[model samples]
Target: MKRRGVPPALLDAFLVLVALIDTWANVGFDRGAPLGCALLASFALVLRRHLPLTTFLLTLPTALVTDAVFATLVALYTLSSLNRHRVLLGICALTYAVIDFLPWPWSNLRATELAGTRNVVHILYSVASAAAPVFLGQLVQARRELSLRLSEITEARENERLLTAQSVLAKERAQLAREMHDVVSHQVSLIAVQAGALQVGSGDPETKSAAATIRRLSVQTLDELRHMVSVLRASGSRPTELTPQPSLADLQRLVDGSGIEAELKTDLPGDLPPATQRAVYRTVQEALTNVRKHAPGARAIVAIHHMNGTIGLTVTNTAPTQAPLPLPGAHHGLVGLRQRAELLGGSITSGPTSDGGYELHLELPIGTT
Candidate 1:
């Protein structure tokens, strides 16, 4: 497939054009061998992507026979970028340096002449230049691989988040089932028993018939409740939620135990619904927990307000004064808190502050269930 922004065919054509220009600048038009070899190297770039090794081999003759080595360098870079064989790339680069440094005719290789200072410097320069393309290509390959790894990690984390959310929902449903069975069903059973006693003991026909109807309906309701309880228990639920949930009254105790320097200020009414109060308390709890975890020794401010039918909260923490010790966590606190806020018809917004601090904001409508 063609790439975005720059088409592959166009890029290949451009590379070939540059190679032709290099050849033109280096070789005289009257020299038949140099011109033919340089042209062959220049045209070979079109096959570099599919057959990098073959392309590099095709271009090597130009480096050996003439000064037009641009095509050879480009081909070497292409091969290094595509192939993961370090030994082969090293050999190819060394061979290019040797070909570029040596005298053309094998018979003219004199030991004393090759040992000169100027020739030695030229040889070192040739080796360095040959290694440049290979290094650059490998760097590009590394960056490309890193990007792919990061993408895979991000996708995996998203799947894990979804699973965690499903698990949380299943547990909540199971808890609801337990509540219905232990409380609502118990009350209904009591009413059914009382109705049965009235049906058997009452003398009035109308009252007896009413009692019988009530008992029958209550029994049917209990059967449906049992079925629902069974279905909920069969679901893949984890542990039950913690009992005796926190409330606004527990805000002070939560902060005192949070291990961070924090100040709480709020103007919320005392008559808020239990769920709304719990949401606020949990928001403060989670925010303070994060401050202690991520921003060690940082001062925090928890400000909550109720104005114009909106319950707004802001938890802001300063930059860490000391590095925090690494702690094992499921990283589910914020996910669960967000789920709670969403259920209450609200939203959570969080990010870094301008003073190198982190802030979390929760906005919920007043009296939301």
Candidate 2:
């Protein structure tokens, strides 16, 4: 309803200026009575925006008296622009037309005194004068409404696009998380099992200690992996409860399942925090999986050591005796393991060794549970 940027008072003043110019050009200043009436009609335009109907009614008498065409046109334009009532506008236009064309008090002549052709010409001109501004004002109002509707539609479509993009991104992330859970969890669990077997069968005290550390780490990794999977699954609807997660104790079963020659050495507290345990497990699991894939028939060594407020793990494999199996892989195991370590305030590094093998190392801080 409110006109933006254009002050009502300023617009009214502009309308007054238009009315004054129109009156000056049509009704000369030399004619005192007519000029005075024209001035009165022009001055009424100052309130056109605020009180358009009232201004139009006030100027109607002056328009009839002085025949000030511009003042009447200004009032009609103001009424049409406001677009309050079509019936009222039509009535006002009709009244002005009748008064302007008919031979009345202004012409000091009766209607019968005018010639038929002259009366017809005067009627047509008066009708056009009354109708032209109203038509233009209505056209302007329609265009403004159309522009506002288009703007709203454009904004709605943009918001819809933004929401759709966010939904697609969320779905992609959930899918990636699910894939990682399925592929890497199995490989990591196998590493834990292998480490557990080494701890139970090895004769050397150092070797048994290392095996124990690997088993514990693998079990913790399985637990965290399950938790991550649960989070992914919950991202969608149809939420389901997760099964009990693995712990340090489950590493032996994992090692027994994997057919690989591996050794583990560890000097860590039995009551290690869950986060550190999970980080160590994932590191060892990812390293062993990489060894199996890249260095078939290679012997792997896993060493775990606890220092001041931190735990360190190193997994290294000797050169393979045979070519690795040609297996399709997503190639995201290492990246996922690294991400896991970082999430737990830890770091992991891996590279090919000088001996044509591979080695992975991890260091995790033991933050408060």
Q: Candidate 2, residue 311: CA error in Å?
A: 23
Worst 10 residues of 2 by lDDT: 250-259
* TM agreement with the true structure for every prediction: 0.59, 0.56
Candidate 2, TM-score vs. the true structure?
0.56
Angstrom error at residue 272, model 2: 27
Writing each residue's lDDT as its tens digit, candidate 1 over 1-369 gives 223677889999999999999998998678998899999999999999999999999999999999999999999999999999999999999999999999887688888878879998999999998999999999999998988898899999999999999888889888998998999899999999999999999999988977886788788679878877776776664443333667888898777666568998988887888899999998898899899889987999999998889999999999999998898899999999999999999999999999999999999998686
- Regions of model 2 farther than 4 Å from truth: 1-12, 25-37, 103-109, 113-115, 193-203, 215-369
> What are the lDDT scores of the predictions, listed in order?
0.90, 0.79
lDDT of 2 by residue, 225-268 (tens): 88777777566555667665444554545444344688878777
Report the lDDT of model 2 for residue 349: 89
